[model samples]
Target chain A: MRVIQNEKLRTVLSYLIPFVLIPAVVIGGIAVFRSRGYSYLIFAVSALTILLFVCGFDRRKTGTRRLVLVAAFVALASAGRAAFSFIPGVNPVTAVTILAAVYLGGEAGFMIGAFSALVSNIFAGQGVWTPFQMFAWGMIGLFAGIFAKYFEGRKLRLCVYAFFCGIFYSLIMDVWTTLWTYDAFNLPFYLASITSAVPYTAVYAVSNAAFVWLMAKPFSEKLGRIKLKYGI
Target chain B: MTGFGSINPAAVFAYFLCVTVSGIFTLNPIISVISLAGALLLWAVLPVAKNKRTHIYPVLLTLFCAVGNPLFSHNGETVLLVINNNPITLQSTLYGLFIGIMLSAAVYWFSSFSLIVSSDKIIYTLGFISQKAALVLTMALRFVPLYIRKARQINGTQKALGLYKDETIITRFRGGVRVFSVLMTNMIEKTIITSDSMAARGYSGGKRSGYPLFKFTFKDAVFLAVTVFLTLLTAVPQAKGALDFNFYPHIDITFYGVSSVAAYTGYALLCLCPSVYEGSDRLKWHYLISRI
Candidate 1:
């Protein structure tokens, strides 16, 4: 029992160490660089390196085969994001991000959605909205992790949850944007909410339904298989 | 943005600090325009060219805000038109545009800043905090995507089990609630498991060693110098009452002539640094010729 416990501890340490360290190095380096008036290049390169390292570490731990499956799921999710734009009153990114959250578990889903946004936005060009999108999508993933218990093997409940998450995520993102862009106290609450919030919600709801219906099941099962395969 | 590849992180940080400070105190049109131009220049030089389309959405949003502000709230002095017994003032619309432009510029600046400064940098900068606290924050940041992916998978499984057949919106809503409940439960379990794993690894101790990858270099030093010079230039005058002004009805300023030139030069230099340094010799010649 002692030996087994020791082995388990070692395994846990291996994983947790990187998890703890990566953020420290990156954030610290950025602060130092900023204080010193270092270029944005250092920041960008460092960030990219950390992300790649994290993804690589995750893949290595989980097994390459499972990593491929997650990658595929992410790609599908990305495509779903693209498709959402075509549908009136639907936000593909929000729907797909929510679905990815549901199917992949939180961290993977967040990474997939965030990475997809990051990579895709590269083609679209990075703007102030990228971080917001990343944060919003990431929140969807976080919620997924938080909410994963009640969703265990239940489809209808999962769909319903996803829809709400979709709407909620969109609403939160819109509110943030409004706060950042507009003066909240001075402006009438209803007006700001109506102009910015409503339109996004309408689109988010439609996209949530469409994407969830299309890819949720197969992807979920695939993620399960991958999870089991790697003993995650 | 091309030159962002070489520009130091400190300069970018200083730029962000300046913008944020300027924004809080004076959100006037001229200040916004200058800031906007600065942000645009930064964006232009960054490697963001790889993803140009994403740029459009923000521009569209800016346009929407500009147009939307006038149509809704008709307030202010300089009247532009009267419709349906309501006066449309030029001041209000222009003010709206100014606000819109400021918002847009701020947004773009943040985006550029984020792109340059990743989550790692955030953690690194906040290194003085205890490792446990940092770990939790990082985990929270990291957990978002993980949770979303899991929720998505579980949702699919539930749907397949014929749990989503009821078509009514209310039933569907209930069904959604049920799914969320399940997802939440699973997330708790996962969090517990992760926490256990963390604790087992002896994470309860005091400050751990810093991240391995972060190390400063000589280039970093040079970057710091430039950033300091630029920041000081902007901060001294702006912090004092010397650089105060407004843009409405017409461009008005107390600081005219040399002061204006200095301000413009400082801003222009910041904007042009990346371009002048990064451009090819031929492109540099062309730029010089254009300036001439």
Candidate 2:
């Protein structure tokens, strides 16, 4: 099942696919292939970006326990998504990813967020927006990890962060819809999309805050205890 | 996995990739129709259990695309109607229809794609790039169901213990969160034990290799070659801008030469390959049984 046999070529491609080839497709699609509905190309680029990060995580030499821990976080987040599937635009994936990132680091958080989207979409349905959703959720976790210090023990700040994550996720998905439907970032159409999505966005933002406020204490305590007891 | 699913996943993936990329990029209504028909045909031919409800989303998506575009863009000369001092032109509406067809075609293609390419196939494909990510995906997939069951168990325990009165929606949600929190702890503890056991078994101590689940047979090669050839046949014309379609101030399709026809044929054949293959495979099985 090896596609690229040579190690050097594989490494080069591992980097090149994400950085060079994907960007070229994105840029070239916009500049040259605009009328051809290049939004799908943008979708491909987003998907590839997630793949690049996953590959980067793969390349890092981590312990087996840490590997398992990352996988567990991903599973928990997606399970959270499945649990809250009845609600539209409200899920604990962002909160769980934030908590995981706050404890594990930005990289692990990103993986958890991205992989949760991929894994959950297996049941919830995958579409052009899958990559965009992954990227949005992954970025939420990444920022949460980066600002872990600010968010730690400050439940209000964590809620605030989750609120913004909700907004960010919706906005990013709207960007995808606009690009997908119109084939360009048509400003009027994008604004129309945002306006139409206002209700969902509000629910998403409020629910994210609620989830964070509810889950923050339990998650922090559990993760902190596990870290101390098991030395993960 | 049977019928179309029996084909090497890589080959199926390649076939879908070509069909989708070319189908969307061609931007011709005629070709879009072919693609939509071909996608629906493939869905019909796949041996997986068919669900009536599953067809609704693509229909709604197509309708949304068709109706939504004209509201936003006011291009073309032939104005269909005037609403709020804005003209809904024929060109924009038709273009929207084209976009809808293209998108729904893609949606159908990918839906069937997910049905054919199961999680194991996905892992096998991802294993080429990064075995670690594949391993994580495998583990995470395994854990999702376990955590779900664990959450249910924890919820039952909490109910039995009279921990929280679950009368209202808020209480139920709180109860769910409590179960989720418990599941999180259980998951972490179990993962640690699993990792420990894996470490004891000398995991990651040596070069890792995966089980060879699929073989690229001669049939696969032939299938892949045909896919590539058809793709190139269409792509050459597409790259040359021979299939350029415009839905702006005017509706124009300039090139209708032999090459353009060839490109359309090539795309149609590429899109139809899977369905045709699946149909033939089913007929062969029926014939073999009848002979027996």
Candidate 3:
């Protein structure tokens, strides 16, 4: 594993790839390609975004304990998803991700969320939806990490966040289905899709809140102890 | 891992990626049908587990997409029905059918992909980008089964101690949660020990390289070359609008010129590539065994 030796180049590349290059691919495909078929472009962009997030995690000089903890969190989240598979649209993945982000920081949160999606899908089945799932959950974790201060000791706010993360995940997935189905974001089709998915969204959102309400304190206490004991 | 599955994971990944992506993005009914049929054919040829319910999801999805489209988008000239003063146009319905086929085709392709490209291959593919990400993924994959086993063990211990009950849904749920919390504490504590042992073993001591389980051979190259060539054959003319299709305002399909004809042929052959390869390989083996 060759670490990027130059700090300046690593920073520039990280910023440039996501902000500059990815948008260019989307804009350029839409503009120059003129919609012959750009669903592949959507797939590429989502996949590349996931790759970028993973790369961002890799670039950090994380301690071994932290790395192993990230792996454990991913396993836990995936196990939660698997355990709750009997119930449709109900999983503790989002709750676990938010907890991890709040405790382990944003990068670890993203890794757990993204890899949970990936690893669970390995058994549940991968599809066109897999990348979007990765992107959506990864972003939820990232934002949770970014806003960890507001969530500190505020279980109510955390529940609200988890609830919205549910809706956010569904809506993001709707964006993919619309784009994949129509090759364009046809508004009527998009709205219809969302309307059809409303029940799923509601169930998942409520479940997320419930899971957070149940698990937040225990997770926080356990993670805080581990952090203090191991200096992770 | 013989025949098609034996190919290098990277090449196999590329093949599925290309085939599924093209199958998905194309809107033409002819192309969609071809892609769907090709996917089913490959799936039939592959040694995949199947039950009575195997076809249910894709069938339901196809039907939903077919019926769901015209209910929302009332475009096109051919009015099939009128519902609440909104016209259900034939074009929209047909578009829905095509889109459904396209989506289900991608679904079959992915199902086959999962069967072919196992998790280790997925990790191998990921290793190309970020080794640490791959390592994390590997460790996480390892931990899932271990945690599941540990969770079961914990549940058993609780049951043995008469501390667990599952007579009702609430009790079951509570028991599961208790087990999960216990597992979390156990995992966190074990994580420290695991990391310490890993560091002692020089897990990240210096530049680490992965052991190569797969070598890209001549078959991989040939496989990739054929896939790329066929993709270009379809994509080039597709870019030139030879495969352009319209269904909203009117149902219009591109006239098959020489290039478009070749493009369609290329796509059909590309879709059949896997099944044909597998079938011929089996035939060759049969003949070799007969001679022996």
Query: Which number leads on TM-score?
Result: 2
lDDT score at residue B137, model 3, on the 0-100 scale: 88
For model 3, how does the per-residue alpha-carbon lDDT over A1-232 read when each residue is reduced to its tens digit?
Answer: 2234455775687677777878765664443234434676777777888978777776778899999999999999888788777677788889999988999888888888889999999878898888878888888998999999999778999999999999988888888788777777789888888998999999999889988888888988998888788788
For model 3 the local lDDT of residue A104 reads: 88
lDDT of 2: 0.83
Please state the error at residue B38 of candidate 2 in Å. Answer: 0.9
- What range of 10 consecutive residues in model 2 chain B has the weakest lDDT sum? B206-215
Clashing pairs in 3: none
| Residue lDDT tens for model 2, B41-96 | 99888888878887887788778877888888887899888999999888988988
By TM-score, the better pick of 2 and 3 is: 2
In candidate 2, stretches whose alpha carbon ends up further than 4 angstroms from where it belongs are A1-32, A37-41
Task: Give the residue spans of candidate 3 off by over 4 A.
Answer: A1-41, A184-192, B160-171
lDDT for each candidate structure? 0.53, 0.83, 0.83
Interface DockQ of each model: 0.06, 0.59, 0.50
True interface contacts reproduced by each model, as a fraction?
A: 0.04, 0.66, 0.58
Pick the winner on TM-score between candidates 1 and 2. Answer: 2
Q: DockQ-based ranking, best first? A: 2, 3, 1
Off by over 4 Å in 1: A1-73, A83-105, A185-200, B1-26, B36-67, B74-87, B103-224, B235-268, B278-292
Q: Per-model i-RMS in Å?
A: 13.6, 2.6, 3.4
TM match of model 3 to true structure: 0.92
